[model samples]
Target: MLTIDINKQLGDLDLQVNAQIPMQGICAIFGRSGAGKTSLVNILGGLSTPDNGQLTLGATHLYHQQQKINLPPERRRIGYVFQEARLFPHYSVRGNLNYGNKDKDQVHFDTVVGLLGLTELLNRYPATLSGGEKQRVAIGRALLTRPQMLLMDEPLAALDLPRKRELIPYLLQLAKTLNLPIIYVSHSLDEILQLADSMLVLDKGKVLVNGPLHAVWDSAEMRPWLPVKEQSSLLMATITELNQKYRMSKLSLADGTYLWINGMPLPTDSKLRVRIHANHVSVCINRPTDSSIRNILSSTIAEIIHSESNDNVQVKLAFGDDHIWANITPWACDDLALKVGQAVYAQIKGVSMTESELAQSF
Candidate 1:
């Protein structure tokens, strides 16, 4: 496990972070800009020092305020990838990768090249490569260093939508295929949802929440950071069927409610986590006789939350042990006469099932 208990004062901002992250999968540091996400990672990478704290990875002590133990950046064995691909323009892909290793044979060059799909671009220079390609090379360089852990700070933030999609699979593959631990920092919720097995949420340099992705994603503490229209709940389900002609997949939720999502055909029996946005779900008093919406599940009203404007309210619905949120106008809530324990039908208009939204459960 990775343990961190740190207190620092950076000018006007004070940072106090304490969390234990699992050493197996990707642990994401998520928050808005100026939340000190970068600063925390810098501390981990040995680029910055905290005023007082203790940090350890497995049995290695990276920092201890009282003991005066502090490792320099080069000795920390932590690889860092920033938002931009800071590659040397004069170096070729292979040259830049080799810069980290004293002996090329020390690391499996071919394996790293193949894993990141850089075999064809080894002879190319950084300027000739696309944004995604440059980032891939950056990752390969980091891996060649044989680091104990990797710190990635918004690695995909500089890429366009298409490039971001292209690079996400490689990240997922890295997380699954390698034994190395990763600390990913990002402000984008989509990226966190896609890659994070665990999450550490920061607000103004303070740790607000840290836990499994599902717990933190659905917790009340996360609601304020999410826009009213983008508020969502995550459902763990298994893909039971797929219709190739219609381009849709049927997922069976734990409560036995089957939901159809738009996407390329996925293998049957594949486990997935589906994001159901509040605005996409409409609460109905009774099942509609005919409707275009594909998913309508029986749910119970758990609680009602009114927005600050008071013009609308978000209804918390419970399906078996699972919970989801629905955003509707106060007038609609009154017309439907919603109350705690009332049975209602939730009509899910559509699910956002992009590559980033759907992650294969290990």
Candidate 2:
């Protein structure tokens, strides 16, 4: 169990966070810039001291205001990777990696080196390493510490598209094997979706919303903040087959149903995600007898939300465990007779963004 009750002031922003992160997997701090996410992670990692708080992981009390307990950074045994690689300009890649070691320890040398594929670049200097390589080495150096938890403060912010793309898979693999809770700070929504099992959204030092990744999307609080159109549903599926003749993709969902899509990132043998936008989805009272839409799934009306401007309605539907949204006019809602528990057909015409746009651009 990782718990925090902290109050601190930085510049014009004030932070009062009281949250608990279960001690496993990755948890992201999400928000726009100036939301005080970095400060919270810094305080957890012992890089910054909070005005008053009790910070602890399991039985270990890292910070206690009443007890006047505050551990130093080195003693905290927490790994940190910032957005900038911050590799030493003068040191060789290997030297910069080993600089944080309390002594000459060989415990994590080979495994860490191999995990990041740093063996080929150990002899190279930071100036010669690519952006991705430097970040990999930075992560390797942090992992070599064998810390209790990891603090990643927007590590991909400075990297280009290719660099970010190159690092995500490795980070996923690293997270799976780390066996420790990770405090990830990120401003990108897609980054949180891809890497985080859960997230906490911050706004001006206050926790706007925090829970499972989908919880942030489900809450009414997100209705105004989210771009009206970009909001969509996340559906997990297996690539059942490739329709080479028809130039389409087929995905098999867990609910014993198959959906045909344009194209996906997965190989025919792999699993991947498919996005269905509510605005792009049309509802029908019956399975259309003469419809061009290839993907039609059974759904029920769960909720009807009006547009922020009150010009249209956003219809929410339940399909098995997954939910999808649709943007329709008030007249259309009445015409279709949409209501909770009414059987309906979710017609999928040509999607807004194809399979490629379903996720974040690399």
Candidate that would win on TM-score: 1
In candidate 1 the C-alpha lDDT for residue 188 amounts to 83
Candidate 2: 10-residue stretch with minimal lDDT:
353-362
Candidate 1 collision pairs? none
- lDDT (CA) per prediction: 0.87, 0.79
Clashes of each: 0, 2
- Per-residue accuracy of model 1 over 1-362 as CA lDDT, tens digit each: 89999998988779899999998789999988988999999999999999999999889889999999999989988999888989999999999999897658744888888899999998999999999999999998998888889999999999999999899889988878777889999998888877888899999999888999989986888885677866888888899988889888888989788888888546999888777788778898888879988888888999998888897798999998898898899988888778999999999864455545576776
- Estimate the TM-score for candidate 2: 0.90
